[model samples]
Target: MDQFTLNLLVVGATFALYFGIAIWARAGTTSEFYTAGGGVHPVLNGMATGADWMSAASFISMAGIIAAGGYDTSAYLMGWTGGYVLLAMLLAPYLRKFGKFTVPEFIGDRFYSQSARLVAVICLIVASVTYVIGQMTGVGVAFSRFLEVKASTGLYIGAAVVFFYAVLGGMKGITYTQVAQYVVLIFAYTIPAVFISLQLTGNALPPLGLFSTHIESGMPLLAKLDQVVQELGFAKYTGHSDTTLNMFLFTMSLMIGTAGLPHVIVRFFTVPKVADARASAGWALVFIALLYTVAPAVGAMARLNLISNIYPNGTQSDPIAYEARPDWMRNWETTGLLKFEDKNGDGLIEFYNDKSKNEDFNAAAAAKGWAGNELTVNNDIMVLANPEIARLPGWVVALVAAGGLAAALSTAAGLLLAISSAISHDLIKGSLNPNISEKGELMAARVSMGVAIAVATYLGLNPPGFAAQTVALAFGLAAASIFPALMMGIFSKRINNVGAVAGMLSGLLVTVVYIFLHKGWFFIPDTNSYTDAAPLLLSIKSTSFGAVGALVNFAVAFAVSRATAAPPQAIQDLVEGIRIPRGAGKAQSH
Candidate 1:
């Protein structure tokens, strides 16, 4: 079959499977819609959580970042995964015991403040919306590439599919569908990685193969990558090149952000018991680690593969002829992810750091009769193009297309649920219409879902940045605001409404202002007043500032709580109740 037909068949079949499951698991009540009726098996919930957590950024863009950034990219893997350890131990069990429909609901009831709930709602919406935009963009990219449609057209189709499944299945449908998505995406991701590892190092294991000796040159894989990159005037693959302080803060930010994200935290609420919540987190990590561990390998191998393809005879010779570039190169170039400029009227494509400040490398290139590197490829293309790069069969390439769509669409559905629940359940029903009927609430949820998807699709067309960086902002916002309030609600019954509100407002404002100063206000052009070259405080990049914001939140909450009257005795009892695993009442329906 042709590539397009195969891609359609695979992607369509997956969508049909999810749609069928949604039909079978149609949520009959608000409890089912919000928490999957709280009977999801721990292992199944873990798989769903893995699929939920590993969005387009994890499945599509993570390896590309590692490929381009090398050792510095370890922050993503470490920060993202390590945060789960914190969630499993410190937060997940208690939250699950609380047994609420939404994160804000827990904070509202525990803190005894409507305003506190509102603050949590705002924070949740911001983080979830920002994160969803990245998924929409990924869906658009995947669709356009594989389906031969424009990105906007792809987004509409993707949105339609998500609407059908998400509106029909709600949490129950999304949860089970995510399990299927996890299987498809993980298989698609690891298979190419294993093949590349075997071809490069004669080792079957991608992670170990990354450290093993390269079969071609008998040098350690990392060492070989470092040599080739340096020969092209790029930073060494295994060396630390970024500032230590920034790296530390960035990693911390991602960790806290991961722990705080509402979409991920809500997954724990779907399981049956507190222990299941904890165990599910561990299982989620195991599943997530499968991809995380192999990611570095894929990145390094793909980088080496591209370098090798460019310099068929090594860096000691002329570049590969432009017309002789691999099919993957030509295919990706059409997507604008890869580009080539035939500088100096040569028919060859040079791939190197032509703008390097290294005088020695510049002088050497000049002596070699080369003008500059003529190839430009976006790092995001590495994963999606891996199968094509290895000359794999069309089925493998088609499976990858389905996998990318699954990754993007599954996360998009999850975020849409979060957004819809926050609006209809938390904001509209909680505040504006406390007497809303169950039928009315369900309709509201569906309407909110439709609106959220529209907004996400609009923003995705005008993306502010790459998937990972955009996701970082969302994490930072969640870490700064919602996470602190939820933690304080469970751990400290002394925290009053005033303390919770003050802490969330302070953290949210500080983080948003700091990010605006660096990333532009609302991410519009010409709004940013400062660059990373001269940061506001301690040289912290906007992406790395979330941890500091979280710290600020904790400090402010404690200080305010000490000065104010403690929460009522009833609130203290509520806090204690959520801490244990037994006798929790049935979760409320609308």
Candidate 2:
């Protein structure tokens, strides 16, 4: 069968399975819609959480980031993984013990103020919306290539699919559907890595293969990658070229952001008890590690494969003629993500880092009649294109297509659910209409999700950055606005409602403004007053500004709390109660 037909068959089969699961597990009440009726097993919740956590950013863009940026992008892996640890240790159990339906609800009650909930809702919507833009971008990229459609059309299709499953099933349906998604995505991700690893290193395990010798080069795989990339004017594969402060801050942002994310936080609520929440977190970490450990291998191998393809005779020799390039390049070119221009009219594509600091390489390229770099490959395409680039079977490619969709759609559902819940459950029912019936609230939740999806789809078209970069920005925002609030609310009895509201607003505003100054107001192109290359702050990129914002939040909250009255005695008692084991129902502050 043709490639398109194979993709359609595999992708369509996955979609059918997802729809079937959603239908079977469709939620029937507010409880089911909100928290899967609180009955999901720990292992199952962990699996679903894995799928929810590994969005298109993790599945599609993370390896690409690693492949292209090499060691500089390790922050993403470290940050996201560490962020989950933070969530599990510092936040998950306490929040689960609180027995709230959403993060905003928890904040509202804990702070003993409706305004705190409203602030959290705003923070949740902003962060969740930004995060969904990344998922939508991943969806568009995957569908655009595999389904043979325009990126916008692919986005609409993705949004529609999410609408069906997420709106119909709610958390109950989404939970089970995400479990199935986890299976598909992990297999899809690791299978190709295993194939590529075996092809390159003669090792079955991708992680071990990364440290193994390259079959063709007789050098360690990473050493071979470093040699090839540096020879072609790229940085060493294992080099740490980024600023230490930026990497530290970026990782911190992602870590705190992961802890603060409402969608991820809500996963714990789906379990029956606080202990289940902790167990679920452990299982999620295990599942997450399976993919995380394999990623560096996949990235290094794919980078080597790409370089080898371009310089079949080695970097010192002439590159392959444009017309002689591999079929993988041709396939990706159709999506406009991989482009080759015959610079200098040589009919040969020279793919190298033109801005490399190597003077000898620059002189050689100039002597050899090379102009600027002739090939442009989007970093987001690397993982999805890895199988084809390594000449894996067509079935593997099709499986990858399904896996990418599953990653993007699964996370999209979770994010939209968070947004919808914040709106319908926190904003509407809690604040606007306390008398809203369960049915009405559920309907509001569905409608809110539909609107969130539409908004996300629109923003996806004009995303501020690539999938992973956009996600990092969302993490920064979340880290700045939400993490401090949750921590303060749980750990500090003195942090009153005024303090929480002030801290969240100040943190969110500062971070958003910093991002807007660099990334454009609301991410409109060319409207930014500054760029990440020359940041307004001292070497702090907007993506890494979350840590700074978070500090600001903490400082502001503490100052405000001390300047004002302490929390009510009952509130202090409630905070004390939450720290103890089995004090959930017994605490009666609010």
Most accurate candidate by lDDT: 2
Query: Can you give the lDDT of residue 122 in candidate 1?
Result: 93
Question: What clash count goes with each model?
Answer: 0, 0
Candidate 2: tens digits of C-alpha lDDT, residues 1-590: 99999999999999999999999999999889988988899999999999999999999999998999899999999999999999999999998888888999889989999999999999999999999999999999899889777777888889899999999999999999999999999999999999998998899999999999999879898888888888889989899988998889999999999999999999998988888889999999999998999998888888988988988887545688898999888888877778888878988888888898999999988888889899989888999999999999999999999999999999999999999999998989988999999889999999999999999999898777779999999999999999999999899999999889999999999999998776656556552122354677877889999999999999999999899999899999988877764534311211
Clashing pairs in 2: none
Q: Give the per-residue lDDT of model 1 (tens digit) for 1-590.
A: 78878888988898788888999999888878888988899999999999999999898888888988898888988888888787777788887777788888888888888898898999999889989988987887788778776666777888888889998889999999999999999998998888888988999999999999999999999999999989998988888877889889888888888888888888888887777888899899899998988989998998898888888898645678999988777666656657888877778887788877789998998787778878877666678888887777888888888888889988998999998999999999999999999888988998999999999988887665667777877888888998788788888878889989899988988998898777655556442122343567877888888888888998898899899898899889988887787655445553
Q: Show where candidate 2 strays beyond 4 Å.
A: 520-524, 527-531, 583-590
Q: What TM-score does prediction 2 earn? A: 0.97
How many Å off is the CA of 144 in candidate 2?
A: 1.3
